[model samples]
Structures are given as structure tokens and as C-alpha cells.
Target: MSTFDTDLLIVGGGPGGLATALHARRLGLSVIVAEPREGPIDKACGEGLMPGGLAELTSLGVDPAGMPFHGIAYLDERRRAEARFRGGPGRGVRRTTLHAAMAARAKEQDTEWIRTRVNTVEQDAHGVTAAGVRAKWLVGADGLHSSVRRAVGIDVTAGTPRRYGVRRHFKVPAWSEFVEVYWSRWGEAYVTPVEPDLVGVAILSRGQPDLAWFPRLSRQLAGGERGPARGCGPLRQVVSRRVAGRVLLVGDAAGYEDALTGEGISLAVKQAGAAVTAIVEGAPESYEAAWHRVTRNYRLLTRGLVLASTPRPARRAIVPAGRLLPSAFRFGVNILAS
Candidate 1:
């Protein structure tokens, strides 16, 4: 008989992994989270949580503080379009704030944490082992460049148009209640109001991100107290599957699409629940289909938007099109938000 340290050993203690730990504890499963980073982990992201994602986190008993935006806005030099989520408002919380809330909730539920990084994984018919611990099941919730995914031999490749994102915070009062996405010839800049006096700007593009690409936005942020810039990507990660024997992958480790639609965190939290569900049911393979169901809308919509925005003409047309077709824009936004 094999000895187990916990029922579930999660590699990575970011939002997704911590969420998985929380879910596992709710179902009476012992969980151990291995993460090298300390609390309040921060990352480069748009920092806007859709209503659907907020609901998921609320259900998990985590309520992070942040500015609440009722809708999304797309803007260009002259045109602007807005879409309010039909369901409710989404919060624009800093990455660190969100992480801290989830981590605290997980700890309150008595989830164990270990300080270590997992470089390799070993699994057998009975269980899986990594980072000097053994568990009946394992999950990889690590980010874009996941050592756990690679260690488990999950096939992954970079998607086309190879995009990347960089984000920085400025100590300027948010100018709008909506999460504003500025469209430019070079790329898009996402301005999210994370706090009353703070806004996060994330740039996504095919090449290196530069705020100068949007002259108006650059001028608006010219003299604010700017925080250090953080970056991530080649945005799209194409993974072959989400299940490997006793191991499962969630969040970016499972697979990823471009962050053009700003649904990454919400989708990740949903995936965590699905992962824990499959584990509780003793059907790890079910997680693949569950993951598919949870992420289908995000993948399709985000991928479609990424492809449409690849060309200069289509990119320029986006804001105008949103203005021209307000109903369509609102419908699309609400679908993702739901």
C-alpha cells in the first residue's frame, strides 16, 4: 500500500490552485499546495473580473476589495462603444489583492502549503508524487510556463500571431467607471480601475508592449506615480489534453487563449471547481470534458476576437463596429460574462 500525504497535491499556489484547495476542503479532501512564491502573488494581467467569475469566487467565500465597473468600453481616436453586463458589475481588483483573498480563504479552510517548486513529476497506478510529497491525485495550476505541465509530458505548443502582455499601475484617479480598452494601430491597452486612485494599464500586442503606441493614453498617464511593469506570454498556449493518469491540469497549465477578452481569472476559477468535482467523483478523465464545457465560450470568443484583430483594417473596425452594432456587442459581452 502506498502512503499519501494528502488526498490532493496541487502544484502552484496561485488563484487557481488555491481555489482548487478550497473546493477540495469543502468536499472533505485533504489538500497540499506547493508553491515557491510567498503570499499576495502578483502578475501581469488586465485585473478585471467579469461578473460570472466574481460569482464563482463569492461562492468560494472570497470577496476581495476593488473598484466595481458596470461594463466594458472600447475606444479609438474618435469612436467609442460601451456594453454593460446584463448580469451584474465586475470588479477591477489588483492581482495581488485577488491572490491574497483566495489564499486567505484557503488557509481558513485548513489547506496545507509547502514552499517549493515542482520541476518533475512521477505518477503510478496508485498515486502521483512531486516536490517530495505523495498524494492520491495531483493538479497543475501553474501559469503560462508550467513546469508541472511539461514535467507530466503534456504536449503544448505556442499559438499563432504570438502575442504578449505587460501591465503597470499608475497612481492616477480612474477617469471612467468602465474598464476602458484603447485600440491603436500597434495593439490594445486595457485600463482597469483597481482602486479609487489607482488604475492598471495592460498592453497586449504581437511584439513588445509600449505605452507610447497609444499617444492619448500615454499623455493621460505621463506624470502619475507608475509602478514597476510586469509581463507574461506568448499569450496563447495550446495543450493537447488536461488529464494525465492521476494528474490533472487547471488554469493556464491546462491551456490558454489570448487575454484579449479579459476572462482568464474567471475561467480559471471555474476550472478549479470542475477539477475538484471530477476528483470527488473518482473520474479524473471527466475533467477534460468538464474543462471543455467551462472554457468553451471563452476559448471561442477570445480566439475569434484575437483573429479578427490581427489585421489592421479589422482592428480599426472593432470600435466602430461596436458602435454600429450595439446589440451585438452587448450580447457578446454578456455571453462571456454569464
Candidate 2:
């Protein structure tokens, strides 16, 4: 048998990567994590942690502070509908705050971190290696464009009408208890309250992000202190598979559809636990099926909604549909919440 430097080597240092490190440690595996960026890392996101995701993080002993939201609200020029999560409220935490909390938790669990990016991934029967570290198993928790996924020949090409997200913070008083999704002619604007006086506005659209496109949101945010805008995506990535040999992929690195549903963080955390379970059981193949189970709801619902909203007329019907079918809409919200 070959010797290994660590029980597991994790690529990427974002939330998924750090969460994997913490979970692996809980399973008695020694882990080394490689990440190029320093904390607390910020990304363009809606910043809303769904109730299910919040519980997952709390269960992992990571409870970050932020504003609480009762549920999700859909609004348009003519219609509006809101539903509260039956279980609990999701929190709107800043990306940096989330990163700091998760990173601290990982460090406290004794997971070692290397400040470097993973450029290559090599594997064999006995072990896998990346970023110069050899381990019994390797996990790719890197983001949308994961090098490990590419190295393993599982990276999927993104197809269009590829949606993109741009998020900016405004120093304005939050006016609602629900995470508001404002639908306009061009795209959707997600307003999440991260603090008592700060709201983050994230736009998801195929067209270029112009505030003029969301006239209502633009006016509401007028006169507020604007923070630098951060952007991400063409918002769709497909993976041929989640596992190859002794290496596995987790979080966004595994596969992604869109951020329209606001389930990213929670789903990633759950996938981390599943990935570690498969690693601990010495069954990489099992991770693929487990990944499917973990992401099934997200993939199906997000993809279906994206498809439904692709056409102009259908896009206009979303808010009104929710308003007309409150029960059905609430069921959808509760399903994702739990």
C-alpha cells in the first residue's frame, strides 16, 4: 500500500471546500485544503440562506449572524405573492461573513490550509493528489469552472441563453421581512437584507445588467450608498459525472443550473456531508448517486423554472401564477426550504 500525506486533499477554499474539510475532520480524516484567495471571500450572490440550508450549517456547528427572513416574496408590476417557510426563517448573510465563519470553524477543527490554487490533479489506484499533496482521496469543491473537474475530463460546457448575476449592496433600510424577487421586463432582481441598514440587490438575467431595466428597483435604491458590483456566470454548468476513480466533486464543482432559486449554499453544505460519507466508506462510486440524491430537487426545479421562464410570455406569468396558485407556490417554497 502507498503512504499518503493526508487522508483527504480538498481543492478550493470557498464555503463548499471549507465545509468539506470540517466534515472530513469530523469523520476522523486528516485533510489539507488548497485555496488561492484569502478570507473572507465575497462573491456575487443573492445572500439568502434558505431555512433548510441554515439548519444544515447550524447542525455543522457553524451559525453565522445576519438578518432573518420569513420566506420568499415574488413581485411584479401587476402581481405579488409571498410564502413563508413552514420550518423556519432563512438568513441573509453576507458572503464575507459566511466565509469567515466557515473558515474559522474549519481551522478550529484542525484542517490544514494551503494558500495556493490547484492547477493539476493526478490519481491512481491507491490515492489521488492535487496541489502537491498526496491523499487517500481527493474532492473537488472548486467553483463553477473547476480545474479538477476539467483535469478529470468531466467538466461540462455551459450553454446559452446563459444567465448571469451581478450583485451590489445598498446602504438602505430593509423594507421587508421576506427575500423579495422583483420581476421586470428584462430580468429578476433579488433583494436580500444582510443587515439592519443594508440590502443586497442581485440581478439574474441573460441581458446586460442595467439598472434601467429594473425601473422600480432602481428607483427604490436611488440615493442609497452603492457598493462595488460583483458579477458571476453565464450561470449554467453541466458535469458529465461527479466522481472518477478516487476523486469526487462537490458543490458547484459537481454541477449547477442557476441561482434563481437561492439554494446554492445550503445545497453545497449538504453535498459536503454526502461527499465525506462516501469518502469515509471508501466508495467513490457511491458519491455519484448520492450527489444526484442531494441535488435532485434543485436541478429539477431550477431547470424547469428556467425553461418555463425562457420565453417572454411565460416569464411574465411567473409572478401571477404564484399569486393565483398560492398553495402550489407554497408547496414549492416549503420543498426547497426543507
Candidate 3:
């Protein structure tokens, strides 16, 4: 028999990994998380937590402080459309704030942490080892470019219409209760109210982002204290599979589409639950199907929207279509929300 340092060794200490730790602890499994960064790690994101996602975090005893948004609004120079969430209001939390809350909750649950980056992985029929820890199962919750995914031989390739996102905070009061998305020929700018006096703007585009794309939004943000910018890219990551032996992928490392729909964190949290459940069942490979089920709606809707918005004409029609077909818009929003 092989002795193990923990029941689960999770690489990356982001929301997904922490959530996995919390779930594992709840199920009486010892977990060790390896993350190179310190607490309150910030990332380039829209910062809007959908109602479903907020509920998931709450269930885990993590409630980050931020502004509450009732729905999502789509806008252009001439038109606008809004879709309210049916269940409850979502929160727009800063990435750092969310991370801190999750980390604290995981700590309270007795999840151990190792400050190291996992570059290589070694697993056998008995257990897996990485970052100097041995465990019965391994989970890769690392971001888009996951080394563990590669170390486990999971094939990944970049997808087309390669999109990138750049985000920063502005010291201005939020004007809308809805998370607003301003569209232009250049790209889309997502304005999420993360705090009463601060809003986060994330630009998504095929090329480098420029605020000139949305003149009105730029003007509205003029003179506000601008924080340092952060960026992430080629939003679409095509993964061949989610499971390799005893290792399972979660969060962005599992797979990714585009951030246009704003449900990344929610999906990550949900996936963490599924991953932990698979591990607890002693059937790691079952997580692959579970992953597909969790991400099916997000994949279909987000991919279709991304494709539709790729063309300039279709991009221009999005808000108008939502305005004309309010029921369809609400249905789509509610589907992703659930």
C-alpha cells in the first residue's frame, strides 16, 4: 500500500481549486492546493457574478463584497436592450476580493496550501504526485495555459476568431444597476460595477483593445482614476479531453469558450463540485462527462453568440434583436444564469 500526503492534490489556488478544496473537505477528504501566487490574486475579468454563480459561492460560505446587479444590458450608439435575471440579483465582485473570500473559506475548512507552481506531474495506479505532494487524485485548476493539462498529455489547441480581453478599474460611481455591455465595430466593452464608487471595464476584441471603439463609454470614464491594466487572451481553448488517468481538469484549464457571456466563475465553481464528486466516487474518468454536462449550455450559447457577433452586421443586430425579441433574450439569459 502507498502512503499519501493528501487525498487530493489540486494545482492552482484560484476560485476553482479553492472551491474543490472546500468540497473535498466537506466530504472528509484531505486536500493540498499548490498555487504560486499570494492571496487576493487579480485577473483581467468582467467581474459580474451571475445569480446562479453567486448562489454556488454562498453555499460554500463565501460571500465576497461588491455591487449587486439586477440584470444585463446590451447597448450601442443608438440602441439598447436589457434582460433581468429571474432568480435573484448577481454581484459584481473584484477578482481580488473574490479570491480573498474563497481562500479564507477554504482555510477555515482546513485546506492546506503550498506556494509553488506545478510544472510536471507523475501518477501511478495508486496515486499522483506533483509539487512535491502525493495524493490519491490530482486536479488541474490552473488557468488557460495549464501545464498540468500538458503534463498529463491532454491535447489543447487555440481556436479561431482569437479574442483577447483587457480590464482595468475606474474610480467613478456606477450609473446602472445592470451590468452594461457597450458594443462597437472594434469590439465590446463590459462595464461591471464592482463597488459603489468603482466600476471595472473589460474590452474584448479580435485585436488589441482600444477605448476609442466606444466613444460614449470613454467620455463617461474620463478623469476617473484608472488602475493598472491586466490582460488575457485567445479566449477560446479547445481541449481534446478533460480526464487523463486519475487527473481531472477544472476551471479554465478544463476548457474555455469566450468571456462574452460572463459565467466563468460560476462554471468553475460548479465544475469543482463535479470534480470532487467524481473523486469521491473512485471514478475519476466520470468527471469528463460531468464536465460536458456542466458546460454544455455555456458552450453552446457563448459559442453561438461569439460566432454571431463576429460579423459586423450581426454584431450590430444583437441589441436590436434582443429588444425585438425580449422573450428570447430573457430565455437565453436565464438559461446561462441557471
Using lDDT as the measure, which candidate wins?
3
Query: lDDT of all the models against the reference?
Result: 0.93, 0.90, 0.93
The sequence of per-residue lDDT tens digits that candidate 2 reaches over residues 92-144 is 99999999999999989999989898878889999998888889999999899
Each candidate's clash count: 0, 0, 0
lDDT of 2: 0.90
lDDT of 1 by residue, 171-235 (tens): 99888889999999889999999999999999999888888888878888878999999999998
Cα error of candidate 3 at position 39, Å:
2.2
Output the lDDT of residue 182, model 2: 90
User: With candidate 3 superimposed using the best TM-score fit, by how many Å does residue 213's alpha carbon deviate from the native?
Assistant: 0.3
Provide C-alpha RMSD values for all models, in order.
0.8, 1.0, 0.7
lDDT of 3 by residue, 123-222 (tens): 9999999988989999999999999999999999999889999999999988899999999987999999999999999999999899989988998899
- Each candidate's TM vs. the true structure? 0.98, 0.98, 0.99
Please give the distance, in angstroms, between residue 321's alpha carbon in candidate 2 and its true position after superposition: 1.0
In model 2, the worst 10-residue window by lDDT is: 210-219
How do these models rank on TM-score, best leading? Answer: 3, 1, 2
